[model samples]
Target: MASVSSSRSSPIGKLPVDVFDSILSILNEEDRDTLKNCSSVTKQWHDRCVRIIFSSLDINNKNTNAFPAFQTWLSINVDAAAVVKTLRIWKLPVEIDVDQLASVLAPLAGLQNLTLQFIREPQSQIKSSSPLSIQGPRSRSLNTLELLLPSEANRSMLAALTVICLFDTINTVGMQGFSSLKPDLRSTEGLTKVHQLRLQYLPQACASEEMNMFSGIMTSAHLRSLYLECHSPSSWDGLRILSQTFVNLKFVDLDLVQLKNCVKDVDWTTLWKALSSCAQLQRLRINPPSLVDALVTAPSKLFQTSLTSGGCWEVLRELVIGPGYSPRAESLPNRIQRMLWDLPGIVRHDLRGPFPNLDTVTVEVPLSAPMQKRDENGRSNGLAAPTVVSSEQVKSAIVRALPSLQEEGLLRITVIGRT
Candidate 1:
């Protein structure tokens, strides 16, 4: 009994410190919970793992209290904020206290990315104070900022922009679900080092005021990549801002989902006409930049009329038709066929045909089209399940419609996200 007790109590051969260190170093954010549980294993391990685990702080409705707790803890332990490199807060309508926001962010000297998606409409009556700038060269490490669903660019948004000015490293700034009904434009003035901009989901009837706000704050010459997606046709008119403001633009992505009551509601030529006004573009003819990527949801007839006659798509080096970047946008079957055929004598015009650079038009056809199957009466769009159309039949249909691509051995079909 005495020998048995001694054997059980004695420590087994332990892993060497270097081997244990090697194993712990291999752990990443995916093993965050495991790290949290094992932090007490060693003092050195705790210090190293804590930084890795807390590098990204995501605060949403589920963990609303976590932000405040972190705020309180960071107030006492200033060094703790250094570990956090990214901060995200989503679906929370809490009033953004600008001064408090600055105070919280000031200590996070290494914070590189920040995303705020608040479910609130800015009220005109909400009083605001100038954002207390978090001054420090290290604070400039912030590189990406995504501001979504704020609806209006009020003082809160302005304060956020002010905070952004302290960080010149910020390369991308996204403003989504914003309308033209913003506060006075004079306040949003600042020169940002923004290289990429995303203006998505703007409301109908966008006008000069909303578009002017972006041109006022951002540097036109420095901007390179521009992405615009909205339901409003007038939003294209806003693209005029790029003509003078963003002169150095190299790439443009558009996901315009026009509101069509009937078949003829959308003017097929409107989008191409707007794009014709890009920086180097002339009045009638187009000498657009190298790339113009779009995920247009218009009908095949619209594409047939527009693409052939609209502008010189022959300049396209890369083009993706079906659901390239936007989920809300879709490509119909007939639209792909329209893209394939080059009807030279169909119209009196002889401008568009035989895309020289475009060898393959990569179209991503979602299996959800037939697999999930959309319903007529349901509010929910699609539920991924099974197909009414078989993969073999789909291939056969493609072969019949587009024989040239297959003959050249450039055609390939893939079915994804369905068992």
Candidate 2:
């Protein structure tokens, strides 16, 4: 047994070089690149490593000289071309001639992921022989597509829109533009596989109308996961529309604080109704004002009723109450306690709260001083002890309010605050 173990541990008696090279070829490009750099130290390692490292290529610069060289390299290494799984081409000064772009991308039929960025301009006229004009059906293995637009105002909106609308099999899509436009699903009807969508920097216009359109798109597509961040107030109407449409959603992360101006005139009641309707919600993260206020102002019957009485909080697994807006020194803890207790389904009684299934509670607290350490003798070290409420007291209040939940299996609680 000892002789067998010793032989297995010896790298000198490992598999032959060809077998090792074949194994390394299966790794992703980042790992393959590392192996390639290490292989260059010796002639024996160089031949085995270079094939895997150069198997995938990224052409990022748009300079004329690099483009031709890249084309030449591709022509000389036809076998290696089939191994490329990811392609990223960017910084093109002018809108690429549709035919030229297609010719470059055609050889990469095996590409599973593609990214095009920094398109300075897009052509108004589609070349008759260009790939852009190729309307016949073509099968592609592409599943993920990311397009980044230049920040220039004169950028070609038509070309950018065309490129985005063309990907038929994309399952994940990300775009950064002036406004998050819901893709014309009609244009990419074959993209039924798409489940994840991200929209950033959406322009604020007539918030209500745009939001309605956006909601219509989401409901029609049955998107499962969504991330939306907008900086303009006009984006609020869109958010409100989403709150109304995505009631059956499972996961959502909304950054509405970026659109402070749009929310200035927000209808709190409508937003609350939208939040209450999300019956299948598993994970949710939004700024405090949007989520906390809705819970506090929800109908009294919703909170007062038992868990089996169609209360919305019964399904919630996690609750996070963030910091208050500009808390006053005199009534900070009072306000925090009131907000915590007032939360529907959360009880002040010893452990009989409505959140029976709640396993975690996160609350943001503010501190006036640094925390002090306790000595082994059970005495305070007195290192300018922070004027903060005791965790035990807070825990006691929670335990008393929802004893039933704690008894059932509640185990973890976290309080987040600034010192």
Scored by lDDT, the top model is 1
Q: Which stretches of candidate 1 lie over 4 Å from their true place?
A: 1-42, 58-72, 90-99, 119-139, 152-160, 182-190, 240-244, 256-263, 277-310, 313-315, 323-356, 371-387, 405-419
Worst window of 10 by summed lDDT in candidate 1:
1-10
Instruction: Write candidate 1's Cα lDDT for 1-419 as tens digits.
Output: 00000111111112124433444466665554455455346656655555654577665544445456556656654544677788886664424554455656777877778887765534423323332232434236457898765555434455455555656656888876654345454543334578878876656666677567666667666677777764655555677654457655656776544333322344546655555445332111111111112212332343345544445543444444332221222223432343322221222242224234445434344354433334664232455453355445545665666566657654555555532
lDDT of 2 by residue, 1-419 (tens): 00001112111123234534554567788655656465335744543443454444567655534465555555654654565677777675435454456566667667777777755534433333221344645455466777676545343333454454344445666666643333222332332234566766576543354455445434434556666675664555566677676666666665554444343355444444555566666655544332333333442222243333433544667655444332222223333443353442434442235454566655544333233444665445666444444545555555565565466664344555543
For model 1, what is the error of residue 191's alpha carbon versus the real structure, in angstroms, after optimal superposition? 1.7
Q: What is the TM-score of each candidate against the true structure?
A: 0.63, 0.56
lDDT score for residue 109 of model 2? 61
Indicate the TM-score of model 1. Answer: 0.63
Candidate 1 residue 355 Cα shift, in angstroms, is 5.3
Show the lowest summed lDDT stretch of 10 residues, model 2: 1-10
Q: What is the model-wide C-alpha lDDT for candidate 2?
A: 0.49
